[model samples]
Target: MHNESIRYLIVPGWQGSADDHWQTHWQKSLPNSVRVEQADWLKPRREDWVGELQRVIAADSSPVILIAHSLGCVTVAHWAQLAPLDTLRQVRGALLVAPADVERANCPPALRNFAPVPEHLLPFPSQVVSSDNDSAVSALRAMEMARNWGAEIGILSGAGHINVKSGHQRWEQGFAYLYRLQGRIEQSARRRA
Candidate 1:
């Protein structure tokens, strides 16, 4: 990112993103990015995960842009609802990718706690990126969530889950979206000032 002062918060979902995952790659490459470590990745508790994210953010003073995938996406939404106004303001924007529809009927048992995903619009700008055939969520469902959250949506064709298993490593396309989101966030901040 061009903004040297901005921090990148990497939040992974479920068992955590694999070494080959794009989130991991980005964290490794970005000097200012750090993972919001969770206590239990195999069996995530919403309270615990959200608390960890909050702790990490509160410990930092710089503005942050969230990079989240799968369950991590839902976690960010939940935190947005729970974070204090001051802490929330520090978040510049978010890149929510392949967000799992935890509210869906087939919601996995481990992920049930995250069900009823926060419905309120995030105070900061954000974008939702989804694949046409992601098992966690369908294109239509993802688009709906994006609209509901007041975020820009991007739909990619035939990109299953947009994960390593789906062959997404060092996803350059995703980086393009990240850059655009950063620009929008920076522009909005300038206008607000």
Candidate 2:
């Protein structure tokens, strides 16, 4: 199937992306991109997040690419561990950005339950982008998680939190990376053929 036919699901972290967030903009720009709406954003129940993702994936027969930020990245990782291998095979790729340490997010006690999510490599190709000055996870720790997940690392220079507060309005570089990932996905499909 054509890449355009694939479903691009955007998973926002705690508090969910704002109206002007980059993810929201991406969803508007990309034809197939849609947000993975969770039942509760503040309380952040891991099982609920995973269940919603599974439901979304089940609803769409097209390939899926997950774009996750903050705690959402952790949700993706946690889901990967439980999702059937067959369901996982349909995932084309993932873009993990500013993943929360959970162990160090100074998160509320409710969210604290999900800590130090398993550091296992994902079966599908993925990219982990981190900021040099993220308050949530140190650059070193983010790199460590990237290595653990076997994902390519993209370091943002002097960026903090990589959020709206970091002055990241028009993230051209991120779009460039996504374009490159599209090439990688096409190459993988060719290999399968």
Candidate 3:
């Protein structure tokens, strides 16, 4: 990926990326990276989430590479359906880590209503990472969501929800997967060239 066109946009789930969260570390470490700021971090309304993401995307000057975890991934998928066709086309790629697709399956009771997963496949290349032992969303559901979205899958061993509470800190493998997605985006660009 050429540094010029590359813009990293991180989306944290629920209560937001905490000080010790890996997503926060990644945003701090990477250049041209920022997380989509939501108005209310505690209670997440679907439209509110979509609106915040839309605003972020609109404010971006260049194409974006999104890194979304848990509910943030859901927010991205939801926002895709509402985004302008050109803005949707401008999203270069995405890395959805531990996506909670069927939130109604086994997640927190409050999140159960986030069901009926959107039928939007990312226009750009993307990857969905899942964990075998994620209690929030089963591995089967994760794979199912990835298939539904036509995304590549990366199954991890036992990371529950792949969050800070799950004991994930400075996840090197996750970063590697992001790099792989970046490569895929670069290859797609080359193909178009």
Candidate 4:
């Protein structure tokens, strides 16, 4: 199956990805891709974020694939934990990158509501990409989160946060990961058929 057959949702983290961020780049570069717009990016509320994500997913009829970064990954997890079976069935897969450890001591106060990250395994296929030296999240914790979410982990050596500031502008490798996710979605569809 081609990427055009899938609906890609771009979920940005924290203050949201800047114009040069990879998430934004992919949103622009890919067809049938839309960003899950949050009302407030600076002061994130877990419920609000998850609501918006669910709203977007509910509005789209096509098979959904999420490309989430940092806190956005947490939003996906929270939604997956609470979403209805129909909503869960619509989600084909997710590419979770640089999930912020919101439980960390130094985590910003605004993000504390997202703490106690949902431990339930995602109902759909997913892959997690983490950096070895992410300032917001430790590598060990990233791996642990991947295990908890039942997602395959991809460790990038010394890549800080895997954001634009980390020198990952137009990250081709990340695109490759999304492509792999599409393949997994296709395989799953084939099995179901």
RMSD of 2: 1.6
List the global CA lDDT of all models.
0.91, 0.84, 0.83, 0.91
Which RMSD values do the candidates have, in order? 1.0, 1.6, 1.4, 1.1
TM-score of 1: 0.97
Worst lDDT 10-window in candidate 3: 101-110
Q: Can you give the lDDT of residue 146 in candidate 4? A: 95
lDDT of 3 at 6: 69
Candidate 3 residue 24 C-alpha distance from true site, Å: 0.3
- Residue-level lDDT of model 3, residues 1-193, one tens digit each, is 6676667899998789998888998998888898999888777888888888888888866889999988888888888777988778779888999887554544565555556677667677889998998876778888888887779998889888888888887776688898899999889888999
Q: Show the colliding residue pairs in model 4.
A: none
lDDT of 3: 0.83
Worst 10 residues of 2 by lDDT: 105-114
Model 3 error, position 95 (Å): 0.4
Residue 1's lDDT within candidate 4 is 41
Off by over 4 Å in 1: none
The list of candidate 4 runs beyond 4 A from truth reads 1-3
TM-score to native of every candidate shown: 0.97, 0.94, 0.94, 0.96
